[model samples]
Target: MRAALAATGRVVRAETFRLLRKRRMYVLAALWWVVLPVLVLLLARVLQVTLTGSFVEGEAVSVKTLLQGLASPFGVARVGLVAPAYLSPSPYVIAVALLAAAGLGEPRTHRMWKSTLVAEPDRRAVLAGTFLTMQAFLGVLLAGAFVFGAAFGAIGTTFLPTAAEGAWGRLAGLYLLQWAHLATLLAFASLAIFVLRNVTLGVVTTFFLPPLVEGLYAVWRATAGFEPLNRFNALFQGLELQATLEAVPRWFLSNNLYLPARTSAAPLLDEVVGTLQAVGEEAGGGPGGAQIASLLGADLTLPHAGLVMAVYGAIFVTLLVVAFLRREVA
Candidate 1:
C-alpha cells in the first residue's frame, strides 16, 4: 500500500510539473482567468454609461448585478440589445477547446504515456495522475473566478444596484456550471485522442467541428423537430456563461430598477407564474386566459441547468476512464 501511494504521488507530481512547463497553459489561464472577466465588466459598465447618461449603480454590486444591469437597460440607454452580442459563448468554447486538446491529446502527441508506463507500468496509476492534475488545474481556475467575481462585484457597488437572493444563487450556479462545461470539453477531447491518436487534428476538430455542428444541428432540429438532438443542445447551452442569464427572470424593465415591486413573494412563485404563462400561450390560449391562469399556477423549478451539465460530465469522465484503460499506449 505504501509503495502504491508513493508511485501515485510521483505520477501526480510528474504530470503537474509537465503541464506547468507548457507556456500555452499560462497564456490560456491568464486570458480566461483574468482578462475575459475584466473585459466583460468594462463592457457592461460602458453600456450602462452610454444608455442612462450615467452608470447604473448597485447598492452592493455583484457579478450578477453588473450582468443584469447590462441585460436590461433604461430609457435613452436602450442599446441593451447589444448586450447579448458582447456576452458571447465564444470565449469559453475556445478556452475549453484548448484545454481539451492539452489535457487529453497531449499525452498522445508527445508519447509521454509510453515512457511513464515503463516506469510505473500501472495503467490506472497513469490515468489517476492525469485526472488529478486536471482536477488541481480546475480548482485553481475556479478559485480565481471566485476572487475575480468578488473584486468585480465590489467595484460595481459604486453604481447603486438592487440586490436579491436569486442573484447570489445564480452566482453559485455559474461556478458549478464551469466544472460541467470543462468536463464535457475534456470528455470529447479525450474521445478524439482515443480515436485519432494525434493532438493537432484531435484538438482542431474538438474545437472547430462543434460550432459548425451546433449551427447545422440547431437548424435541422428546428425544422425537423428532432427530440434527441435537443437534449444535446443542452450540453452546448450549459457551457455558455450567458446560459444563466437566459434561465434567470428578467422581471422588470431597466428604468424601473429603483422602484421596488411586490417581490416579497418567493422566487418559486414567480417562476411558476412565468412557466404557466409560457405553456398557456403555446396551448393557444388568449392573453386573458394566460393572465388569469398564471396567477393560479406554481413555479415548477427543477435541478438547475448546471446539474444537466454535471450529468454530461459524469458520462464524459466515465468514457475517458474506459478509453484510457482499454487502449494500449502505442
Candidate 2:
C-alpha cells in the first residue's frame, strides 16, 4: 500500500510538472495570478473616481482628488472587495478547470499512464496518480492567489485602510471555500477527462455544468424547499454580493447572513424595472455611507461561507477518487 501510494504521488507530481513545463499554461496561470489582480486594482481605482463622482453630486472631484479620498478608505473598501477575491472560490474553479482540462486535452504529450502501466499494471493507481497530482497543482495555484491577494491587499493599505483582523479572518474562510470549489472542479475535470478523452469537452463541462446545475436547482428551489445542488453554486462562483443582497428598507443590503449593509442611495436596477411592482413602498430611498458604517461597525462574523465551501471540497474529492479508482485507464 505504501509503495503504491508513493508511486501515485510521484505520478501526480510529474503531471503537475508537465503542465508547468508548457508555455501556454504558464502564461494563463500568470495572467490569472499576477496580471488580473493588477488590472483589477487599477480599474478599481478608476471606478472609484467615476462611480463616486456619478453618485455624489456637486462633489467637485477629479481623479486625483478621488484617489486621495480613497487612500483613507482603501482598507475598508478592500475589505469589501479585494480581500474577498483572495479567499473567493471562483478563481480556483476557473484556474483548475481550464488548466487541467487543457492538460488532459493533450494526453498525447504526457502519455502519463503508458510507462506506469508497464511496471504496476494497476490502472486505478495510474488514474489516482494523475488526479492527485492535478489536484495538488490546483491547490498550489490557489494558495499562490491568496498570497498574492493578501500582499496586494497590504500594498492597498498604502492607499486604502489598515488591515483588520476580522477582514483577514473572513479572507481565510473565503479561501477555504475556494479550496473546496477547486476540489469540485478538479473532480469534475478529472472525470470528464477520463470519459470525454478530450480537454475542450472537459473544459466546457467544467465551466458550464456548475452554473447549469445551480440554475436548474434554483428553479427547483423556488418551489421546493431546499435543492441539493443549490449548495454547489457559490463553490463555483466568485462571490457576487450585489446580486445576493436584499435591500432592506433604510437599513441594510442583507444577504441574510447578518453582516452590516453597504449604503449607496442608488436604486437597484431591479427595483427600477416595472416588471415587479412594489406593494406599499416608495421606490427611490436607500441608505447612506453612515448606515453602511453602522452596519459593518465590526467584522465579527465567523466564516460560514468558507465552511460551506470546505464541504463542497470534501464531497467532490471523495467522488473524484472513487471515479478515478473505478475507471478503466485504457
Candidate 3:
C-alpha cells in the first residue's frame, strides 16, 4: 500500500511538472487570469458609458458603482458565494476539452506514451495520476477566476451585499455541481483523444458535438412535440437544474447582470414565470411530464442530472482505461 501510494504521488508530481513546462499552459493561464479580466472590465466600462453616459470629464464615479458595473462582465451577481454569471458550464467545458486534447493527445502524437508506460508500468496508476493532476490544474484555474472576480468586486465597489440566507449551503452544492460538470467533460475528452489519437479531432468534437446534438434534438422536439431529448443534453441539464434549484432568485440575479435594465418589464420575464408555473402544475403528472416540468424551473432535482453526468464520466474513463491497457504501446 505504501509503495502504491508513493508511485501514485510520483506520477502525479511528474505529470504536473510536465504540464507546467508546456508554454501553451502558461499562455492559457495568462489569458484566463489577466487578459480575460481586463477585457471584461473594459467592456463593462464601455457599456456603462454608452448606457448611462455617466463618464463625464470631471465627474467622480464611486468605486462602488464601478464595481457594480464590473459585476456583469465578471459573472459576479449578488454578494453571495454564488456567482450567477460564472455558473454557466461553457467555461468549464472549454477549459477541460482544450486541456485534455493537448495533454492526452500530445502524448500519442509525439509517441511519448510508450516511455511513460515503461517508466510507470502501472498504466492505471499513471492514468489516475494524470487525471488527478488535470483536476487540480482545473481547480486552480476556476479558483483564480473566482478570485479575480472577487477582487474586481472588492476594488470597484465599496459595498458588498450579504449573501442571502442559506446561500452558504447552496454555494457548497454549487461548487460540487460545477466540479462534476467539468469532470464529466474532461473524462469525455480524455476518452475521445485516447481512442482517436488525435487532439484536434477530440477538441473539435468536444466543442461542437454537444451543441450540434442539442440543436438537432431541439428540432426534433419542435416537430414531434416531445421533450425527452432535453434530458440528454449536459449543458441544458446543468443550466436547467441550476435554474430549477435557484428558481426566481437565480433568474432575477442572472437577468439583472446580463440583460439591459430596461428589459425588466419585458415579456421574457413573464414567459419564464409562466413556464415555471406550468412546470409546477405538471409535476408528478408522469415521468415525461415530470421531466418536462423540471425543465421549466431551476430543476431542484439536480441529482438526476448529476447522475447522468457521472455515468458519462464513468463510462468514458472506463473505456479509456480498458483501451489503454489492451493497446500495444510501441
Best by lDDT: 3
On residues 13-65, what C-alpha lDDT tens digit does candidate 2 reach at each position? Answer: 76777767867666655765676556656765666656664745355545444
Q: List the residue pairs that clash in candidate 3.
A: 63-156, 243-298, 244-297, 244-298, 244-299, 245-298
Cα error of candidate 3 at position 29, Å: 2.5
Give TM-scores for every candidate, taking all chains together and pairing residue i with residue i: 0.59, 0.58, 0.67
Off by over 4 Å in 1: 1-6, 53-89, 155-170, 208-217, 225-311
Q: On residues 1-330, what C-alpha lDDT tens digit does candidate 1 reach at each position?
A: 677667778888987887788787788667655565556557766655554433434333444444554322220011111221123444444555566566667766777667767888777776767766766676565556555545554454455242212344444444444444455556666666566777677767765665554455435533542235565555755676334422222211110111111121235356666676677789897333333322222221223323444565577678777877888765
Model 2 spans > 4 angstroms off: 47-90, 102-105, 108-112, 157-166, 217-330
What tens digits encode model 3's per-residue C-alpha lDDT throughout 294-328? 33323333454555566667787889889878888
Clashes of each: 11, 4, 6
Candidate 2 residue 326 Cα shift, in angstroms, is 5.3
Candidate 2, position 328, lDDT: 52
Error of 3 at 140 (Å): 0.6
Distance from true location, Cα of 235 in model 3, Å = 30
Of the candidates numbered 1 and 3, which has the greater TM-score value? 3
Give per-residue lDDT, candidate 2, residue 135.
Answer: 64
